[model samples]
Target: MLILYTYSFAHMFKTSSFLMISSTEIGKYIRNMGMVCFVCSLLLIIFPTCGYAAINTSSTLSIGHTLSSPNDFYELGFFSPNNSRNLYVGIWFKNVDPRVAVWVANRDTPVTTSTANLTLRSNGSLILVDGKQDAIWSAGEAFTSNKCHAELLDTGNFVVIDDVSRTNIWQSFENLGNTMLPQSSVAYDIPGGKNRVLTSWKNDTDPSPGEFTLEITPQVPPQGLIRRGSVPYWRGGPWANTRFSGIPGIDASYVSPFTVVQDVEKGTASFSYSQLRNYKLSYVTLTSEGKMKILWSDGKNWTLHFEAPSSSCDLYGACGPFGLCLRTSTPKCVCLKGFVPKFDDEWKKGNWTSGCVRRTQLSCQANSSTKTYGRDTDVFYRMTNVKTPDLHQLVSFMNDKQCYEGCLGNCSCTAFAYISGIGCLVWNGELVDTVQYLTNGEVLSIRLASSELAGSSRTKIVVGITVSLSIFVILVFAAYMFWRYRAKQKEPTLGVVDTSQDAWKNDFAPREISGINFVEMHTIRTATDDFSSSNKLGQGGFGPVYKGKLPDGKEIAVKRLSSSSGQGTEEFRNEITLISKLQHRNLVKLLGCCVKGEEKLLIYEFLENKSLDVFLFDPTLKFEIDWQMRFNIIQGIARGLLYLHRDSRLRVIHRDLKVSNILLDEKMIPKISDFGLARMFQGTHFQDNTRRVVGTLGYMSPEYAWSGVFSEKSDIYSFGVLLLEIISGEKISRFIYGE
Candidate 1:
């Protein structure tokens, strides 16, 4: 699955393309414009905005009014929380229910009445004021002298940009809310000792700052921490290469990783995740109860995928310092092998916060020089399937043996874990937040006195290691076999095409398709929201048609061939070959296509008014079209049909000509669509015969419906039927075929 992106300004419009219009020229242009443009100009001149993508200083956004993101993905306006009287200016998803606010400007100072105005000042700033003209919140410091305007991006970032320079003077992304929208990330400023943080809303009804917050800590190797005020509520382990040391089991293919980067020159460390399952529109929200959950919208519904501190065992310092938290254990908390509970009574009461103390001190800590690890003075006790402790220093030791000896040499080193991704990790002080998962966790070796290890038999340790390795190998083998079985059972899926992509080989595909642009399946998924139900327009014999907008905001109508349709492959190839050869203003233009295994899509230039049937068949919309409009549509259809039969390079016959196939463009000009069942005539051929009849039931001609013969005359008869339907507003029911 992929996410549709509208984030970068560079891709939208280049600054060099902007034509600077002076005040005098603007006035001249306004006077010369048409009535609609004149009215819009008046609105922009006076109040500037009622509804639009961007707001200049001349614009005033009042209550009940909103400025929507370009694609209408996000809205910025004054809104009151559920059951709350006060109103605050916030940004929320345009389609989401319950009005989930992502950012609030007036959380602390809300207007009681519905007369507040969010005004952009000449100083390149925005101010929210109530009816009394008292400022609620003023923000955005000017960075350049260029005239700036504000816009809400599809990524949910509110930015002030230089209208001419296209420079980003200020942005709301710098000042984050409880939600981390896509393209937004937390960074640690080492020199300033400040970090970008997400503070939760106080409660469901209030946007005032809450007690819980999530921030990236700038420890050499930075880790994420959810804090309750100054105290840590939950730890997101450490940035151990591709994963966190303490929070394991995240598939790199799905759950994204926030990799750390230390800028030596700038003296700052930052971690940002540029990839998610579908990166651009995904988000992570910090809840009121102080939990981070990652989610994404599939157009209609938001799917929650991952959550942190999911269990009590995952909570920060659940078993306190030098304590281990295991989900399977009866009490869930226990002291290490070489340690005992500091407070025995509290431990028995299941209050293990007091943690544990070493039963015997390490030899190095005692003598400072008599360190003989695993042999005499001190020994390392291995704890498998466990999360390494917090605050562990990154050790540069290359191998496990070197990492072990490096830790053994240091009297202060309490434990060490050598992981492939992170290399080596050695904890100096007391260990905290150590968790034991059932599977896929790092192993931590704890340093202890030799006397504590003397009781444990060498055979038991060797047997345990052997059994763990054997079981791991068996599980991996079984998983691989299961995956293979599943893959074999599943129907073939589509992939990016280089040569007959999706195993859909065509003799003409290699050469004929050289002129046709092939889109990636990823791009199609992104544009159509993974072909969600919301994007679907209508179902036809071919399959379903969906409305989608490309990254450049170009709208396209995609007809996806159903996987189970036995005849779809042939029809798909027919449409591709026919439409690609024909080009006309009255005929639907074929943009491109995507072919992957069972998936076949035909992309067309989208008609805004949709097909003529929508206007003809619908009761309310029917009245909207006058006789003049109907006559124009009739003429346009006639012109399209004439071109298809006479003018096209290929003498193509759209065998499925019907009211539904006659699509109406933005200007209400009819353009013929759907060439899946089209036929072509060779030199001196006027008619074609077929055993199979394939077309919409109502649009089939009598001669073609009964017999196998079809020609230009037969299409003309169907056209006459379509014309009768248009003029009389009555459909001819010709159910002559199964299709």
Candidate 2:
């Protein structure tokens, strides 16, 4: 028995360690498996998020959920405006501030309770339902589809689709809300007698339809109009050839993206406006106060592009019927030449809403034939620079003369105006909303008895003299402008060096001009491949630098100046003037420049090695530049600065000198660039003071950075920092100075 026990003990001891390791490993594996299974099951049972897409909706979008557009620019969801209790489903800018609703589903019927949802019915109709599944608002249209889906388009349009056929059943654009997005339209359909109008919200917090509505007039050459209930609040005036007569600031010179599609046979018309700026979102919104505004998206907020009723004169009928609103006048309202205020006391009190009445009735449209006995034949009195009256009956007249004759012949016609695009606009009955514009307006002719014209002879004589004097002053100004233009035209835009054989050797009038080559904008565009991403080298405070190959097969670097930068046209001219005269091995060579309107570009010889920072700051590429290479770059930079300070004819102070501004050639030779902020000094001038503290920080001297004073010592201080950065392989900005 002892022998058997000894054998068992020996075997137990040998296998005990193996058994312990196996048990431990097995327990760990089992625990891991259990954890994985538990996690998966929990996910499936508790967090079944397959139905959720950012927010959740398979068939219904419950309250507190949202549907985002593909681009994430817009969102369709539920929210209480101004944090109110009433919840409404609406579309709004996802990232923009002010969070104004662009489109509302249940605007008229608010979901008062929390337990409500926007649901898609089996019949392919969308409905907003309350807690008891009772429909609050229905889309009212159905499509033939077993399964349907809804998608908020990137254009800020919410659409319902037949999933099987991918056919659009309904779109928010079709039934527009207050906001008129790029794709939305103000239209009138003749067949169904249906009209699409933008009805503004009651206020900022309430989605209920307000009194103001924006609609397109269905007449030929359709115009945009804002109505206050059933009455016209403001008219955009008649559509001229390219722009509305009243809003003439946006004319043919400005590229307008407004389209008016009219079908005379079908009696259908649509008015839609869009912004062609890439990725720029803009929408037109009519406010409850009857203000029509075109708001452009600028980052997080909206900038107003245009607003109607901008002034008291822009308010419809501010002076009421037959009275004129003048922007230049003190009291603004005034009666026509042959008319008098209906209420003289009210007129004096600035209450011109009572309008005006003709001094004498038209002989043809008189109450009795005896009214014509003392009066001459009815005549048309001409009024220039006036916003023509509303309620016009379009008549097909060939010319202005024909239009005037037609109006004079009609006993009912009270006023007339001839527009370029829209023929004759003859008004019957009373004239309304006539405005005398200081800048933009059309001519309106009012009908009156010839007796009134005969009575205003003195007034006409005084007006003719005033007009004649004004014309003489305008002619004198025009003559002076023409002479100045002729003098300038004789030379090739001062300091702009023409490369032609007969170039100006010394014709420039600027104080700092020596010579320069003026390149065509077209040539630079072609060389840079229209500034494509592949050709982009780097960007600076001023703007981007592009690598381009010219027609001569010579590689060039184009520095496109930024209009919005702190460095502006002054800096551009300074750079050209200084660099054209500057010639040094260490300085960047300016080949030429091109100025096209707002665009200013400087062309230079392309460096194969790009900038020194590319080698010095890059993680992987920093090692490519060794101690010797870095030392050489430092020496070259020093030489360049020394030339600018002492060696060059004009002592230039490169105010923005830094490592990044140092460009490297194929030989790894450093060259100084970006002379935009450089200042030139004459003899004995050591330093200068400026109110505009400009240039790179950290590299700037303490005195210069703090006191706006700079000198050659400032450049030396920047060089010291740059030298240390090159040696230590660390930016002065990145150093962690600990106490």
Candidate 3:
């Protein structure tokens, strides 16, 4: 009996220290330590044996009893959801605060009595029975053997297994309850018309299924969808190579990589997330509010990584048929081009569900005798950066031009969009749930009457004529002034420099730039609250930057050029002209520019994390820039420089490349900003000489600073200095001084 007790003690601990001791040695040590040691050893052996991770046919888990996973990562026990007296058998995270339940056995059928028990029956089935001895819930189709047991795994999966074969008969993961753990999938069998969906809880306190159900739609190329009853509340759009076509926010470098497994033979598709980092506990949950959110825990608290239906525009058909939803707009909803509000008064009051109607009817209808049989009178208006409307009919083996012709041939076809991955999608019914995105959206072409097209053409022609006439008058006046000045130059006693409006116009002429808004001064003033001191972010060489909130609630950084600054009109114009045309992810986005009187403001996207200099210089913040983050920042800066040097349409050289110019976004992604000193080169023009060497002292290259010769290599030298500063968490000036 003593030998047996010693062996059991060694088996219970299973540690290297305990395993070192032989049975004979353990018995001898117990005898020498007396009854106290023997009793303690016996208790240690019995304690773990009494509370096992798995329950055999002989064991039962009554109310208040719990089964913890081997590693104690998860626990399975009877739980009462917030404010509820009823009990449910569920599995929850053991280490998490506020106990996050992942799987519930009896979610819909809760036991009212406290005497409920979870037991492994002789038939190898795991059953939950209430105080009345009634089976509340059971694992169906038990194994024939009597040696079956139920186990709670570290993966948060509660499984009923046959001990003899060690095969899992049933698992809690198969019957999902709102949450999708890492590697767990939401599957759909297209052939069977069956799916494993996640339904939202009724409320925060209740575990019962709510109105919202999230599942993968069985389309040709499957996509995720959230449905409220029978209608789609929010769609994940069609599946692209990397992510959902509609969700541009889910990038390739996201923490969780979403993968859809499509089995053509089986006709099954499953959407699952593969976590890049296993140490971090993350889950995709269908919230009570009908929003699907991905959250991760950093050992302390849960942080929301991403959420679907995040905006008012994300709601399906929010803008209705023939309407476009713009989240950045004040009203959020507007009619498509050549369409007017169905109810003007209701639309003004923010009721957009009625949608819009065409301003002019199509003349290509079959009933119209004036319509030509071979020729169509309808013209297609191309709308870019838009989410294609719902109820699209896919037409295969058709190119873009063929799709356009096909749509024009049919009077019933309202609109058509050709996606890269998906074939031509033509819409016959009214276009519904169309959303206009600021970036990364499909192009949609809507058929309009010739009269409507003619109206747009006439407006453009009138505007062109007006602009040409205005320019001609200005040129004629400037010519007369120049002639008078030249005649006066012959008899001049002292030379007078021209600094009038005409001179300013000659120096700072407007260029034909696209994708940039010319913001009004009054609007910017209102947004920045009349340039209040509290709104001021920081002052630079150009001027003070102020944080402004637009009428649409978009935060912007307004870089206002000071009149007293050395770099004024030329620098402002240079920045506006250069950055406006450049497009890159690592480069800062220039939203618009405002030129009113003395105020020359450039609007930029508000980066919450601000410049790298702020973090690198500060002792407390420097810790955030670990080795990995610094490496990523270095790579991003390199990519941005490469684009400026070779990849971009214009071969440009950023004269000023420093830590202060490297801005960091909320995700700590570095974006190179401040193109005030950027110089654009013509084709094959690699180097340029300038008398004025404009740049920070420490960051300026030797060739650029001394000889006034600048090239792409000058930026590379500055980048090398900045890279060292980032890695060492020290400024270039400080490093030089220390050396």
Which 10 consecutive residues of model 3 have the lowest summed lDDT?
A: 1-10
Q: Against the true structure, what is each candidate's TM-score?
A: 0.57, 0.55, 0.71
The global Cα lDDT (0 to 1) of model 3 is 0.80
Assess the local accuracy of residue 338 in candidate 1 as a C-alpha lDDT between 0 and 100. 90
lDDT of 2: 0.78
Per-residue lDDT of model 1, residues 1-739, tens digit only: 0011223334533556435767898687667767766675566455432344676777777877677787777888888888688898889888777567888888778788668788777778888888988888888554544477888887888988887888877788888878877677777676887678899988888888899988877664668889999989888777655556667565221124466676656767665555353333456788888888877676667777778878888788989899999856353899988999999999999998999999987657734664554345888898877877888888788778899988888878889988645678899889998888865567799989887877557867887898999999879966876776676667486433332443344446564564476788888889999998999988876788899989999999888888665456678888887887665557888888997655789898888898888998788999978888888788878877877787544577788889988888776888888888889987678789899987766567777889967888777887888988898776677333555
lDDT of 2 at 620: 94
Q: Local error of candidate 2 at 25, Å?
A: 26
User: On a 0 to 100 scale, what is the lDDT of residue 317 in model 3?
Assistant: 93
TM-score of 3: 0.71
Ten consecutive residues with minimal summed lDDT in candidate 1?
1-10
RMSD of 3: 7.1
Model number with the top lDDT: 3
Instruction: Candidate 2: list runs displaced more than 4 Å.
Output: 1-58, 251-254, 276-279, 329-331, 364-378, 456-739
Which model scores highest in TM-score? 3
